[model samples]
Target: MASGTVLRSHAGGYLVYEPELDTVFQCAARGRLKKERVSIFTGDRVELDELDSEQNTAVITTMLERENLLSRPPLANVDQVIIVQAVHQPEWNPLLTDRYIVHFQLELSPALPVLCFNKCDLAEESELEALRSIYEPLGYFVIFVSAVTGRGIDDLARTLANKVSVFAGQSGVGKSTLLNCIEKDLQLKTGVMDHEFGVGRHTTTSSELYRLSFEHFPEIRASQTASWVGDTPGFNLLELKHPQPTEVVWQFPEILRLAQDCKFLNCLHLVENDCNVLNNIDEISLGRYNSYAAIVSDAQMEYSRRQVTSQKVEATVKKVGGRGGKEIHVPRLSTKYRAVSRRRERQGQYEEIDTDDDSIDDSLDATEDDTFQDGIVGQENLD
Candidate 1:
């Protein structure tokens, strides 16, 4: 068996790169892996079998455990995420940028998040300064680069050295263009912004990991370190998840710091009295605060939704023995409407009571019986 890293995944199979051999092989996964529902994603370390050197093909038999994984781009074991945005053309959106930051911060805990603004040549110096002023102080490593002018490319190259970095941002923000500029050999496709829509057309349709060598950047040539960069398809809509209402503050570093002095330990900083975050609101940027507020509101709604869903599930479903003696969740019937088993009826504990008119209890029992039958059908389908 041979060990390699998955560089890309497609409908056909995957492209696995073996570091020791310095070769890439077109590989297909083993049948057992598919049967087990083991997903093979880019950047995953996998063991290979059935190697064919002449055909440059192999079969992936095993996948090693990943250090981390990002669901949006379907990447594993990423060291850092560079959130790229354009200062012009497509335009800069602070709220959207913050959402990405918070999302990665929550998903990739302890992994660094770098902010890169592309198309600097189109933006005024003051505009650039304003961006730096907003995010630099918040401990974000910010870089202003123009792929057209080659500005800050050296700095960006140096930061990416020896790490598996992912380039993520809005489409048409010049992610592909900047990467092409960094390495002419890349030649990744670039797109133009739509004049009417004010958004860039999608150029990168999938995520692929590319090796960045020192030869690409003269400044880092002496270092002899190579980096791997995953160019992911750009997206406009980002949905933040997992963070609870109170935990939302943790994603905003500045607010989290100020929240320490709040009067209530669980204060959400909206309108709570003696809230230090609200008291010192001026210290936080209006844009950042607005993003925080929006995210917190969303988180609160999600939390309420989850609470209601869990309660509903608890009320409607119950654990019961399955065919193979395994416990499974099955639809539960209300005690009031439950049908007495034949064994219970056989005991003759109570006499059968007959009513002249149709009773509400009988109707309810019939409805519940139908519902129970439907639930059984759903469970069987799931099985």
Candidate 2:
């Protein structure tokens, strides 16, 4: 079989598409991909060989290089990310937008992010105008489209032509409605607008790409053809681990502009002395700054936790001297592992101690219940 992108993944396996033939193949891996800890996500281009047409099976032999990837939904080779937000329903969550923007900027090619304000007709004039004014000036193209009335639907349709776009936003933001409007033929299931909450119930349960067709173009008046659009299920809030401050700042155009004047080269941007970020912080969106601050704080806490954890790992590795032949050095923490030894003294069920510098930290402070310290090792990679 030829190379194709993985559109959907399931317990059975993946559905890969060959654009050349416009055919979909059901493929599975010979070995457990997750066992190796490399999650083969959707939007990944892979090489496949047909196992048996009768069995509807194929083997995924190779995965193609990806332009960008994300851990949460685990997708790859995405062309652009559509950030769907509403003018009124569920109100505006700039913090959520920050989360999306932060994740997108970390991508390899600075993937294009388009903000679509759905339910435009429902929005008050001031609300609609305010959103356009804020995001449009910041380099992001803001489109005001009403999925119900078809207001600006032509422009929205033009934007989505011949592209792979992911519709992402909080629950009830009209992602499905917008898709239904764009590809009217699909008549994709959509929930009614909630009068009480002013939001729609999430009708989509899983992420799936749909082929959109237009019979007659309003401008060209030519024959209709099919275009691809991917719709993702709505999420309440994005769960993001602490990311690097440099990466976080880079995501926000406004913050990055202000960060240039920061006092220190490595300013954390939180209560730093003579910090330009802090001084003009109010000028920027409060929600955006808070999101950045939260991630930075998480990173700082994770760092502190790692220091404590490394000390323990170093001591354990020294005691075991395992055959891994790895040198255990716990920086940011004292070489002495006495603190961990003392802490574990009361626990009788402690198994073999791990002292590898890169070993994951298991230590957690009871005083700070939700606080997690960042260490050299990640949540999954730790031995």
Candidate 3:
């Protein structure tokens, strides 16, 4: 049995590698391993038994513990999540960046989050200044690189040396191009530069590891260390599931210190009567508050919208027969309505009465009385 890490999982099976032997086996895990609910995923170290030397197939028997689990791409042992944002193209989305930063900050202990600004060739001097002011002061290492110009790739190359880093960005941010620049032979398809928006199309569809090197361009050598990078497809803008409000407030160091002065114990930093956050909201970084508002509002709106939509969906389902053409009996409107219905049912008075029947009957009687009075008045006029 050889121990190895699973690189990727495909339709047939997973790619398990025994790094010690430098042998990767393509096989599935035993039934017992799955029965015990032991999940084996990409980047998971596991013990494998080689079944056939001819086909190079093997069986994963045991899974080792992981240092960290990046849930989005399902990566198990990772060093850092390299967040790539473009200066132009889709533009710099501060809210999305904060969401990613806070997500990694809450999930990982070592705080391995690196910021990489791709397409820096188009970055303005003001953009660079803004990046330095926002990220550098927060003790984040920011690297500016352009895949086309081969600028700052050396520094980025050194950063990825002897480490496992994942490159994540929105579509058209040039993740595949960056990877291709790192490994020349990898020659991963590069998407066309969108003339309208000045962004590349999403060419890479799967998350696969590419080994970085300076063999292709010896002149670009900086450090001699084996490194790997994972390129993932882009996704829509969404808020991360942060820790509790109290914990989440402390994620931004500036906000954490300012939160001590908040009047209420559970203040969410909104315009509460004596909210310290409100008083200092403008004083501190406006970007930070903007991010907070967006996340909080997004979560609240999502929950409320889901609730209303769910009620409508349930009502529609109840009206139409559910699966198998089964009859669905909706409960009475309320406790009062249920009590009345129960009383009527006990007396065998259920005849599907119209809800407005009594009101309509009373209206008809009143109209008839008025008409008869009018008729008597007309007779007096004639006499």
lDDT scores in order: 0.75, 0.61, 0.64
For residue 146, what is the lDDT in candidate 3? Answer: 94
lDDT of 1 at 363: 14
Enumerate residue pairs that collide in model 3: none
User: Which candidate comes out best when scored by lDDT?
Assistant: 1
Compute each candidate's TM-score over C-alphas: 0.78, 0.68, 0.72
Point out the higher-scoring one by lDDT: 2 or 3: 3
Model 1 residue 216 distance off true place after TM-score fit, in angstroms: 3.1
Off by over 4 Å in 3: 51-53, 110-112, 193-201, 214-226, 301-383
What are the clashing pairs of model 2?
A: 302-373, 302-374, 303-374, 305-373, 306-375, 313-355, 317-355
lDDT of 3 at 159: 78
Residue pairs clashing, model 1: none
Candidate that beats the other on TM-score, 2 or 3, i.e. the better one: 3
Which candidate has the top score in TM-score?
Answer: 1
Report the lDDT tens digits of candidate 2 across residue range 1-383: 57877777644567777767667777775443332333566777788765555665667766766656654434565667788887767677776676676555444234558888887878788988777777787788778888778887787777777666688776678888888776677677877666785555666655666655654345522433435667775543324433444445655668877887776876777878788888897788776678778766655665567678863211111223347785432212212212446655545223213211322212211111011111111322110
List the candidates ranked by TM-score, beginning with the highest.
1, 3, 2
Q: How far off is residue 171 in model 1, in Å?
A: 0.9
